[model samples]
Target: MAMSPEQPSAPRRSRIALWLVLLLLLALGGYAGWHQWRAREQAVVNSTQQQVDALSERLNAMRTEQRAQARRLQQADSLNRVLRDELDGITQRAALLETSVERLADPDRHGAQALRLDETEMLLTIGSQRLQIAGDLDGARRAYALAAGVLDGIDDPAYLSLRQTLLQERTALDALGADPRVRAIAQLDAYTQTVTAPAGREERARDERAPWWQRAFGNLLQVQPTDRAVAVQAADRAAALAGLQLEISLARAAAERRDTAGYRDALRRADTWLQRLAPDSAARTQQRAQLQALAALPLSLSVPTLGSTLQQLRQLRAR
Candidate 1:
């Protein structure tokens, strides 16, 4: 077993070579694992960097949009302020114009002459309305008189001609005569009385001496001179009389309103009722003539120079 030291050194050399080969294999494996880990770490870093860059870009875009919206809002606010200023200016100008107009129309600036002129104009206008609208002749005359008195208080030479015109208008108004309605109403009353009065003894005697055939048929029929048959029943006569009274009342109302056409039409209807109420005779004809006269009466005055004074006054005021 102790044969030679050379044999022992040879075995030792073989063992050392085997140990070196195992060390070399371990180093190569460690190097490969480190390289693979480094590659994986580098890929993760690159992916994380890409995500951060995308987030930064989006943040920049948001900032830009926010700035643009802020600028637009500022512009809108400026426009609103400008519009408000313009509206305020317009309101101020309108108020100034109204104040100026009111100052111009103020009556205190013109003294007594202006007051008189204003009164005259108002009275004249009142008179015109009363005459034309309400058919108030007395009221119109009173207004005209007061207007004349007020106008007389004005000593201005320029208004002298206005007085003359006013006088002329008043004169024309006076010349229209009495109210036709009054005369018409009187005539109607007389007509009603004459028609409604009971017949005299002579008429009763004539009826008693009538022919036998006429007397027999008298209760059934009454032949008028116009060849119209009339009913003899008391109820029918009463009904006709009531209709006549109604028509007369209508005519009277129309006259009060100064409705000329309506007045005439009502009178004509009343005449028709009268024909039924009264038998045809000289008295009936006379009654019809009177009714026609009343129907022809004028309810309103036609004065062409009615508002001449007012027109002249306005012209002077304008000057």
Candidate 2:
């Protein structure tokens, strides 16, 4: 009935314990390997993120450097332009100085007689052109008188006839009157201010106030009166306005050139344009007086010519 020593049972329990310890060791090794793998993956991800951040910083620095370089290039271009302009100015000044030195070195430019003659001739030319173009009679007279005085100082018997011719031209310029085109423009401006209603427009406005039935009857029978004053068509009036303005400007130009006939033609064209645009004789009643006054002026006048005198002076100078 008493228990003896059981070695097999004890050995079986020891073997089972050994198996349990081996299983525990294997599970611990698996967990340690998984943790190390996860750590390596996280480290790789962090390294990649750091490399991307470094690349972005390098890109930003490159952009900033490029922008600064562009600014420097623009500034250099501006500075070069300024320097070029200054250099050009210096070159011009140098050229002008060289011209002055060259003139001083020439011996032929020292004579007072030649200088006076050239100056006088230039004055005569300016005067003749002024008289012919601008009708500046007074300015022409003064210039001719000055030229005659210069000729007198020359004390040359060869220019006697030239002096007499200049005197004659001076007398002719003294007789010239003011430009007549100025008065014409004044008259036109006055006429323009004299706009008036056409004859039948007022009567039509009164007739419009009648009863509706009466107006219908009048309109149907064509017995009651309405305005015969035709309104200016918008398109025609616009064209006429342009034409009138052009003609007026031409008239002014002709007057400035002392072309009496041309000025008259331009004025007449403007008048015709106005008539065509308005087409109401009664409306022109207000401007009739101004129109008559404008028409009364002579179309042409006896303007003195100095071509012969100028030619004779040039011939004398050549002699």
Candidate 3:
């Protein structure tokens, strides 16, 4: 039997309703997908902002560190200037001391001992001033120690002893701190004993066998010279030694401060001095030995004062 038109139309309407429902569902799904995509995009933007902030902070930290390093370099330069000025003053004082010592040894100067004592006193005063200027407690203490030693060696009973017997006196004077008094006294006693004692057996034997007139001439020429060449050579040697001493002091200061450039410059100067002082092969070998000794020392050793520096320099030359 053939179906009625009404029945067929009803089936078609039901199919249309199903199609409408499917279309609605598809629209809802599209909206949900779009919302999810927008949320993901927002999350990506937030992450990017956080990364940018972190980079900016890192850049700022680097800049701050750079500025701090620059400041430290400037401080190092200032320290160098102070050191140079102190060294210049010390050099001047050393020259004066050398002249005084030379004069005191002269036979023509009858009151040479008294003059030497006075010169020693002056040197002590100058050393005190330099220590104050340097602003280094260790240096000041060393200078005071040296001064005390010189004072103790004075044979004159009137200046035999200091008013400040105890370490308290040094503290009151503000010349040297209290800690170095015992050490200074000990050093002074040792130095005095050595200076007053006679020559060693070897030295005495060498002196007895040595040519009298030639040796006398050499000794006299050191202070009272008739020959120009001998005097010139002696003067040149003294000058060179003085320069080497200065270089050694500078190197010591550089090492103490941990300034690589300053240390290198001082080392080069020391090497140059060694080269200049060594005229012959034997002397060169001797100088090389001295240089090696110095090189072997750690680069961080402290040199407190000019006197200490001079002592070290003498040790190097003796080697």
Candidate 4:
């Protein structure tokens, strides 16, 4: 009834074969799991790289925007400086004009002359500034026209004035360049050369004689038409005095009549005179005092009484 040795060996061999098959199946399963894990890790690495690239792109864009903003700030600062300088220049010119106006109120001849000169200078400055502004504005307009594909109207008054001013400036420059004195000064060396030449003495002697017309006129034009000048000067002086006197008289009459409009007009005229007087003249001081006194006078005075008072004052001043 005991089992044979061969039968025991056969059972052991079958158990070994079964163990080998199980080992092979376990090895295949481990290899598949390792492959799947490696694939998942690679996918995660790719996703991380994509995120990093996106972040880099965003950072570059932000840097570009910052640079643009910085440039804009610089341009704005430059423009602000230009505007400030221009405004300062304008303010200085305006202050000078106001000072000149204050000078005009004086009644003295010196003050009047100074005021006239100041006014003339101011007018010239205004014309020059207008010309400059017109040129700059025209340039701006041209640029706009180019951009917008349209031309501005040439018939505009400002445009016409600008053109006229440009023409005048050019003509003035040409005239200055062609002046005899300027030409002579510029050609001094040439003149010297000619004068030193052996054949120059006779020509120089002939040039010394006065022209026939000049000899005949006997310096008539050189006398400056003194009679006419004197008459015109007298007329101008009378007109200026009369204008101030008339305003004062009007103010007095308005006071008598209690007419506010007339009083206001007289005050305005006085103010205008003050503005037209020279700053350093004695006449301006007198005018200022007169204006103050007139302003202080009662607006509702009795006509007869005011007339009597004015007449008495005039008589006293004359005496």
**Which numbered prediction scores highest in lDDT against the true structure?**
1
Show where candidate 3 strays beyond 4 Å. 1-11, 106-319
Task: Give TM per candidate.
Answer: 0.60, 0.47, 0.31, 0.34
* TM-score pick, better of 1 and 3: 1
Q: Weakest 10 consecutive residues, lDDT, candidate 2?
A: 194-203
Q: Model 2 off-target regions past 4 Å?
A: 1-20, 111-134, 147-319
TM-score for candidate 3, please give it.
0.31
Predicted candidate 2 versus true structure: per-residue lDDT over 191-295, tens digit per residue: 544432232344456468867886767545544125533334345556766776788678767765656788778878877766655545665543544554565
lDDT of 1 at 276: 74
> Can you rank all candidates by TM-score, best first?
1, 2, 4, 3
Clashing pairs in 1: none
Taken over the whole model, the C-alpha lDDT of each candidate is: 0.82, 0.69, 0.56, 0.49
Better of 1 and 2 by lDDT: 1
TM-score of 2: 0.47
Which residue pairs show backbone clashes in model 2?
none
lDDT of 4 by residue, 1-319 (tens): 9986755578898999999999999999999999999999999999999999999999999999999999999999999999999999999999998866665664532454453333433433443343244323233323322322211222323333333433444344333333232232234334223322322343234334757775566435434343332212224434544565567567656654556577667866855544332233574465556555445444331112112222332343234
Candidate 1 — which residues are off by over 4 angstroms?
Answer: 1-109, 197-226
Off by over 4 Å in 4: 1-10, 106-112, 115-319
